[model samples]
Structure formats: structure tokens, C-alpha cells
Target: MIPIYKPYMPQNIGVEISEILYSGQLGFGKYGREFENKLQSFIGAEYVLSVSSYNIAMLIVLSTLGLREGDEVIASPVSCLASNQPFAVKGLRVVWVDVNPATGAMCPDDLKSKITKNTKAIFHNHFCGYLGDIESINAICNSFGIPVVDDGIEAFGSQYKGRKLGNLGTDVTVFSFQTVRLPNTIDGGAIVFKDKDLYEKALLIRDYGIDRTIFRSSNGEINPDCDIEVEGYAGLMSELNSYIGTRQMDDINSLLAVQKNNAAIWNDKFTNLDTINSLKITAGCIPNYWVYGTLCKNKTKTIKDFKEQGYYATGVHINNNIYSVFNNNVSLKGVNEFINHFVAVPCGWWFENK
Candidate 1:
């Protein structure tokens, strides 16, 4: 069977992890700092904070906005639910917006139509590392002065015109270095902020208000109980993970080259299939090819038929509105369409010729 979405933990990782363990700085410290800096430069963001998980990053990004109940956050229902979970948990009403079926991106017109006075912000994902209509998304958000929080988890190297995805028109963008991404890091995520002050606030909020120091020194003596503000979550990524992620970043470009090359091959092959439709991308957009998903001609039985032939195709993501409590509460037409027909074929390691 050709399994889908496998992590390519290279040969050098074992030794590298061993060295980090031996260094005794195995927790979040220098390695995390180094990793964050590298990531900041790579994504062209002002600052990056290494966090425990993308979920934690999601939580912080939502909470930092100071949203309250009844406040609405317009979000594309096409992408992963991790993008919306934070907002939902914060008591903000999630106004589900549909994506353009062609680009799989949130329509700027939809943003204008869906946003009411209660709308606090808009959350849009770069579906398959393809940049959305940033000009209009930016202009609309800026017009209302509401921030745009982009879920760029799948768009690590995606670019628009020339600039990286994270830097384009977003108040902030969240990236995941999970076991499956353009470059997998086993477990890590980051929140990239354009403004230095907002970025530092996120940094403080990430690490229990601890910034650049843990314990204070009184004339060379240790000063205890010199606490800063309310201690936040222990969201710092461990040094071991950071070391792994840092090393992973070094090979990211080459790794994605392979993935994209393979995606082109898959796209060509799927073109001849009368029974399936190949996915499409924006003209100038270069996808990280995150998951390399496609839709089944028949939603219910396509996955089963594919698996019967020893292929590991399945629905790529979950529809949040289907999670028990939401069944009768809201109607998600676009979300339903995506979750049903959308199928993800393995990218990194499943290519027959790779």
C-alpha cells in the first residue's frame, strides 16, 4: 500500500538529537532561541516565538486580540479546524465564510458581505500553500481597522509576488512544524508578528511573562520571587525539538523541491484520470504542496475504493461544525462540501517513483 503523508526524519537526526541531549540544555533555551531567530529570518517576520504546539500558538493569537463574547471572527471554513478552535474557545462567535472553489481561498467579496459591526477580525488560511487575494483581504481589513489573522500552517514557503506568505497583509500568521508540514519538526509551531511590540507581548504571554531572564540577581546573589506578571503557559519548545526543527529548516528548501516535483508528477498523472479531477493552484503561487489533497468524484466511496486498491487516500481534514454540539446549531454548506469530497493523497513518500 502506498501510505499518505509520511515524515522524512533524515539519517542525521538521531546523532543531532543525541548531541543536544548530551549538551544538557535539552529544554527550551539556546536551541529554541536559535530556532526562532532562524525562522524569523526565513519567514521574514520581525520576531518568532517557539511554542509547545500549534494549538497553543492558536490560543495565544486569539487571546492577544482581547476578543469577547458576541464578537465575530470571520474565518474560512475550508481549511483545518485548528484555525478556528482558538476563536471558538474564546467565546467569540465564528462567522464561517466560504472559499472560492477555484482557488480554495476566502473571497474578498465574502469578507465584505459577511462582516458586520460585530466582526472583530477575519481568519483566512492559505489553502495548500496558495496565497489568497491579499490585496483585497488586506484593504478590506485595513479599511475597517480589524486585524487579519492568517492561518498559514500549510503555507510555509508560499509566496505572493515575491514576499513570503507570513509577511503579506496579516497582523499575524501561525506556522506549524508538526510531524507533517513542508518541513516536519516532530512538534513545534510559531506565531509571527509584524509589529515588534505586539510580537514581544506574544513572547511574554507565551512564556509566563518571562523575557530574557528567569531569575533575578541581587548584586551577584540569586533573588527569589522576582516574578513578572501572571505566569502564562509553559509553551516554550524544548531545546531538543528546537535543535531538530532548526536542522529541519536547513533542509527545508531541498525537501520541498522534492515534494513539489512529485506534486507536478501527480498533477500530470491525475490529469489523464477520467474518474478524478486534479487540484489547481494560483498562477504565481508556489505551493509547499501541503498534504497534496484532491477531491473524490464520489465522496462516500472514493476513499474506500482507493484503499481497496492499496492506496492510502482519505479525507484530509475535519469539518468543525460536524462535531456533535454543532450539528443542529449551524449550517455549514461550504464546509460540508470540502469535508466530504476532499481527499488527500500522500506527498512526501508515497510517490511510486520517488
Candidate 2:
């Protein structure tokens, strides 16, 4: 059976990994640094700190920002579990909000309604790589003096009004270089902070609250032995992963072109099929389609049809509504619709043809 998603491994990935295995420098080193630099430069962010996963990135971003217990986080309900857990993990209460159905993004109106006096930050995930209404979202949050952390795991290159989605809408934009991400690092993540002070703070938090090896010597000399572990986890990406990430980063433009073309193909091809629910895009927002998704007239039957047709498709994750733990106290009409109708159609590097 066709699966909903699979990791992309270009021709040289094994060679790169093999080289690292042979190098005796297996931990975080030059590879992770290069990944951090290349990624920051690629996204036009001021500074980037590499970490183990987007989950660690989120937690670090929150903890470094000084968000604490009784602090409330406004999060889009129509997001994956990771988006909310960081807040919960840091002892902050999460305020669930809804996303706009068309864009599959945070609704600014709902955001305005949800912001309370104790709200510390707003978190948004770029669901399915569709761009969020980031400018408006940022505007509202900034007016209320709220920090916004973008969960940009799925949207590596999604842009809003010419600016990338993560960069435009939030103070800290977190990305995952996990296998599921656009530029796969196997398992890694980073937090991009546009502000200098915030960037340093995040760096310290990632390294265990200490500050050393902060940069290469002025003469460009490097020293791994000179180090300090602050209040941090060993969440650095491997150089091998970064090497692959660099390779994938270089290929992103071409890859996105093909994925978007495929999205158009799916939209056009499925138009006549009334039983299909094609994914929607926000006007003027360019999305780097990750898992092209839809809802079926019959969710199960639709997936079965796609599978029968050699397409790997399946339902998606939203809130914990179906989960007994959440019991879902909040009303998330749009999120619930996404949860029920959600089915991801493959749009990665995988091939689909007769």
C-alpha cells in the first residue's frame, strides 16, 4: 500500500553519512554549524541556533523568552501536537484558537478574541505549508506586546507578501530539519531570532545557559574543547545532517517548483471529481506544498480510492479532540473540520504516474 509520506534521500546522502561515520567526529560540530549558517543565510534571519528537533526549538524559544507558569500561550488549535506541548512543557497554559479554513492558518480575528492580559506569546504552525496571515497576526500580537513563535516545520519556504511565512509573522521562527521537513537533516531543528539580544538568550538556553564557543576566534580558529553547557539539552544537529541539509537547501528551489506543479496538477486533475476536497490556498501567499491534503466525501473511502489508484493518502493530525486526555474544551469549528476531512496526498519528491 502507498504510504502518505516518505523521507527523501538524494544520491549522496549515504556517502555523506558514511564520511561522517568514518571521520570520528560524530557529535555536533562543523556540520551543524554549517547547517545553522546556511539555513540562516537562506532564510535571511539575523541568527540561527541549531538544536535536536523542533520540539526542543519550541521549548527553548519559550523558556528563553521567560514565559513561565500562569503565562498563557495563544496557539492555533488546527495544529499538530508539538505546537501546544512546548507551552504545556514549560508550565504555561495554552489558549486554543481556530484557523482560517481556506488558508489552513491562524485567524487574526480569533487571535484578537483570544488574547488575554496574561497571554505571553502566540504560536502558529504553518499547516501543510500554506502561509498564515502572518502580517495581521503579527500586527495584533505586537500591538498587545505579545511575542509570536512560528512553528514553521512544514513551511520552509512559504511566503507572505514576498517575505517568508516564518520571518514575517513572529519574533522567533522555529524550523525542523527532520525527515518530514523540506530540507531534511534526518532529525534536527533551529530557532531564528531577528533580535540580537533574544538571539543570544536563545543560544545560551540551547547550550545550558552558559555562553562560550559563542563564535569562532577572530582569526577564524575553532575550538570544540572550550565549551560551556548552560540550561540546555544536547540538541545539536550533526554535521553530516547539515551536509545533507546543505545539499537539500541548494535543491529547494527546483524541488518546490516540482511540488507546486504537482499541487496544481492534483487540483486540476481532481476538480471534476466531486467526491474530492482539494486543498485551498490564501490569495497572494505562495505555499511550498508539503503534504497536499484534502477531505473526502467519505474519508475512509477516499483514502481507499487514492490507495487503489496508487496514491498514498491518509487522514491528518489536528488537536487532541479524539484523544481522551484533551476532551477538547474549546470550540474549533475550522480545526475540527480539518481533523475530520484531513487527508494528505503525496506531493514530495515521490513519483506518481501511469
Candidate 3:
């Protein structure tokens, strides 16, 4: 049966791995640096930091911000736990914001209403690569002098008004390179920063807060002594994963093109069906269509029918508020409606034919 999602591997991935094995250096070295440089150029970001996983990438971004305990961060209730859990783990309170009924994205009006003195940051997710009303949300956050962190895990190749997702005006944008994502590297992710200073801080945080090349001699020889200023985590991307990701970048455009085409096919096919409703896209937003989703009148029966027809379909994620750690019993009308009707089918590279 066709699965809901599968990792896309380049045809020459074996060659890329062989080169890394022959080099004898497998830590976060040359390939890692190359990957970051290539990614920065690709996404047009001022700075990019590659991390081991999306969760750790979020941790690095939140930790670098130095948020205080009990500080409230406004986030959508329609995202995966990884998107908002980092705030709670960092001792910050998560204020659930309702999503747009049509797009499953943070509602700018609701986001504005949730802001208070305790609100430290605004966290927005590009659900299933469908771009949200980021410009409006960013404008609201900018008016309040609050930073916005974009959880753009499924939107690596997506665009908004001609700019890539990560290059958008958000203060910090995170992208996932997990196995099921667009540009898979087994397990890796990236963080892009708009501020140069924050980028520098994140670099240190990714490697245990120690600068390995801080004290180079006149001949470029490294100094053994280093200074550790702040607590950090081992979140560096391995050289092997970096090499694999770098190779995949070569065919990213083609991969995204196929996903987009397949989504268009599904859109046309479902247009005449009254039982299924396609998700809406904002004006000037170009989605990558990570997972083609529709709001079905009878989602349970629809999923069973799809499986019986040799297609795998399922809900994208459970709302984080339901979990005990969040302890958020608040009712979000849009989120409740979304959780009941949304169902996703494969829209990745593997399902180009359908």
C-alpha cells in the first residue's frame, strides 16, 4: 500500500556517501560547513545553522533567546508537538492561538488578541507547507516589538511573495530535514536567523558554547585553550548527514515540482466531490504541498476507503493542548474543527504518478 510519506533520496546518494567515507573525517567538519553555506545561499538567509534534528534546532533557537521562566509564547494549536513543546521545556508558558479555519494556520486577529505584557514571542507554523498570513502576523508582532519564530518544518521549498519561507521577515525560521521531509538527511534540521548577532550566538550554542576556531595562531594553527560562556547542547549535524543533505539539494527543485504537480492533480480531482474540501492557500503564497490534505465530511470513513484502495491516509498531528504537559483545556473552535475533518495523503516525491 502507498504510505502517507516517504523520504526522497537522490540517485547519486551512494556516491556522496562513498566520498565522505573515503575522506576519513566524519565529524561536523568540512561537509557540515559546506552544507550550511549551500543552504544559506539556497534559502537567501543571512545565516543558517544545521542541527542534528528539528527538536534540537528549536531548542537551540529558544535557548539562544534567553526567555525567562513563565514568559508566554503565542503559538497555534494546530501543529505538531515539536513546534511548541520547546517553549514549555524552556520554562515558558504557551498561549494557544486558534488557526484559520480554511488553512490551519495561526489567525492574525487571534494572535493580536492574545498578546499581553507576558507575551515574549510569537510562534507560527506553516502547516503542511501551506503558507500562512505571515506578513500580517509579522506586522502585528513588529508593532509590539515581539520576535516571531517560524516553525517552517514542512515549508523548506515554499515561497511567499517571491521570497523563500526561511528568508521571510521572521526573526528566526526553522526547517526540518527529517526522513519524511522534503530534503531528507536521515535526521537533521536548520535554523535561519535574521539577526547576525543571534546567528553568531546560535553557532556557539550548537557546539557546547565553545568556539573551536576562536584562538588561531598566525599560521592558522588552532589553540587548545577555549572559553565556554553559556550552557549549550551537542546539536551539531554530523558530516555524513550533511553530505547526504548537500547531495539532495541538487535535485530539490525537481522534487518540489513533482509534489506541487501531484497536489494540483488531487485538487482538480476532489473539486467536484462535495464530501471533500481542499485547504485554502493565502494570496501570493506558493506552497510545497508536503502532504496533500482535505477536510472530509466523514474523515473516518474516508481514511478507511483510501486505505482499502491502496492509499495510506491519516491525520497530520494531534493538537498539543490535549497533552497533559500543556494542560491547556481551552477550546479553540478552528482547531477542534480541524482535528476532526483533516486527513492527509501522500504528496511527496514517491507519489508523482497519482
Candidate 4:
């Protein structure tokens, strides 16, 4: 059976991976720095930080925002738990924002209505790599002086209006490099900062809030003058994972090309289907097509049909609002309508390789 998602590995990467494994320097080092540099060049961002996972990446982004306890954050209900759970864990309240039923993306109108004095930040999740109305969302957030954090887990290679998602005027954008992502690091993520100061702070906080430069003296001994000024976490990516990430970056362009072509084929296939309506991508956006999302009249039957054809398909994520931990019970009309018909099918590198 074909998989809905699969990690891409460059041919003969084992030699480099094996070399890194046997090397004494297995911690976060040169490899991690190289990975960040490649990502910076690809995404066209001024500053980028490599982290252990997307969850930790979100945690680090939120930490930089200085949000207080019970601060309300407007967020899309249609996203992975990893995308929204970080808000609750950071002692912030999540205000559910409705998505456009046709596209399964955050509706700018709903987002404007949800904004209040208590709203500190906005979590705009680009569901399954389909670009949302980010320009409009950013406009609204800017008016209130609120920061926007983009959950670009499935949108690494996607572009919004000629600019990559991370540099598309958003305050902070985070991308996942998990196994199923386009550039799999096995398990890793990157955070891109639009602000240079926040980028510097993230550098310190990602490694236990200590100043690595001053923590040790010239002889590598612990320096007594060095101090831990702010709160932080140990969220550094290992050198092994960083080496793997760089290998993925080496072939990222070709992999993205195949995924885009497959998505085009699926778009044509669903165009005339009587029961299957393809989700609408925002204007002026180029999606990486993590998976081809559809709104089927008979969701169950559509999934079964795909399975019978030797492909895997299903709804990728449940609405985070359904979870009691989020404390958001307000029923969202668009989210309800979208989830009931949403189905995702394989349109990644695996299909072409097969």
C-alpha cells in the first residue's frame, strides 16, 4: 500500500551519517550551524535556529513573545496538536479561529473579530501546506501590534507571493523537519525570526538560557562571571540530526519539484469529479503539496476508493478545539463543515519514486 506521507533520504547518505556517529563531536556543533545556514539561504530569512523538534520550536517562539499567563491567543482550530498545544503548556489561553470551509485555512474576518485587548499573539496554521490568507491575517495582527507565529510544519518549500513563508512579513515562522516532512532530519525543526534581537535571544534560550560564549573561559573551564539571565530550555538539535538535515537540503529542490508535479496531476484528477472538491489555494501562493486535500461528498467512500487503488488517504488531523485541555468548546461552523468532508491523499515524493 502506498503511504500518505514518507521521508525522503538522499542516496548514500549513510556514509556521512556513519562518519558523524563515530566522531567524538556528537553534540550540537558545526553541522548544526551549516544546516541553519542552508535553511537561511533557502527561506531568505535573516536569522534561523535549529531545534530538536517542532514542539520545542514552538515553545521557544512563544517564550520570546513574553506572553503572560491567561493571555489569549487567536489560533486556527484545524491543525496538529503539536501546533496548538504549546500555547496551553505556556500558560496562555487559546481562542479558536474559524477557517474557510472551502480551503481549511484561517478566515481573516473571523480572526479580526476574535481580536481583543487580551489577545497577545496569533497562531496561523497553514493546514497541510495549503497557504492561508496570510497577507490579510498579518494586516489585522499588525493593526493591533500583535505578533503572528506561522505553523509551517508542512509548508517548508512553499512560497507566498514570491517570498517564502518564513520571510513573508510574519513575526516568527517555524518549519518542521520530522520524518514525513520534505527535508527529514529524522526529528528536527527550524525557527526563523523576522527580528534580529529575538533571534539573538533564541540563541541563548535554546541552550539552557546560558551564554555559551561567556560560560567558558579560553581554556574551556567554567567561568564564574557568566550568569544565566533569563529562562530557557535545552532544545538543541544533535550534530547527527543536523548532518542528516544538511543531506536532505542538498536534494530539496528536486524533491519539491516532484511533489509539486504530483499535486498538479491530482488537481486535474479532482477537477471534474462530481463528488470530490479540491481545497482552494490562496491566490499568488505556490504550495509544496504536502498532501492533496479534498472535500468529498462521501469522505469514507473516497478514502476506501483510494485505498483500493493502492494508495493511502484519510483526514490528517482532528480539530484541536475538540480537546478539553485547550478549553475551547465553542462550536465553529466552518471548522465543523470542513472537517466533515476533508480527506487527504498521497501526493508526495513516495508516489513518484514508486
Best by TM-score: 4
For model 2, what is the C-alpha lDDT against the true structure?
A: 0.75
Clashing pairs in 1: 27-239, 208-232
Assess every candidate by TM-score. 0.88, 0.88, 0.95, 0.97
lDDT digits (tens) for residues 27-128 of candidate 2: 778877777777877787767887878888887887778877777777776767766666656767767788776556788898899888988888877787
Consecutive 10-residue window with the lowest summed lDDT within model 3: 215-224
What's the lDDT of the predicted structure labeled candidate 3? 0.87
In order, what lDDT does every prediction score?
0.74, 0.75, 0.87, 0.90
lDDT of 4 by residue, 69-130 (tens): 78889999899888988888987899999999999999999999989988989989999998
Q: In candidate 4, residue 272 scores what lDDT?
A: 82
What is candidate 3's TM-score against the reference? 0.95
Select the stronger candidate by lDDT from 1 and 3. Answer: 3
Q: Which residue pairs come into collision in candidate 3?
A: none
TM-score head-to-head 2 vs 4, winner: 4
Residues 269-317 of candidate 3 have per-residue lDDT tens digits of 8887888988778899989988887889998999998899988999879
Query: Could you tell me which residue pairs clash in candidate 4?
Result: none
lDDT of 1 by residue, 39-94 (tens): 87888877667798888888777666766766778887677777667766677777
Better of 1 and 4 by lDDT: 4
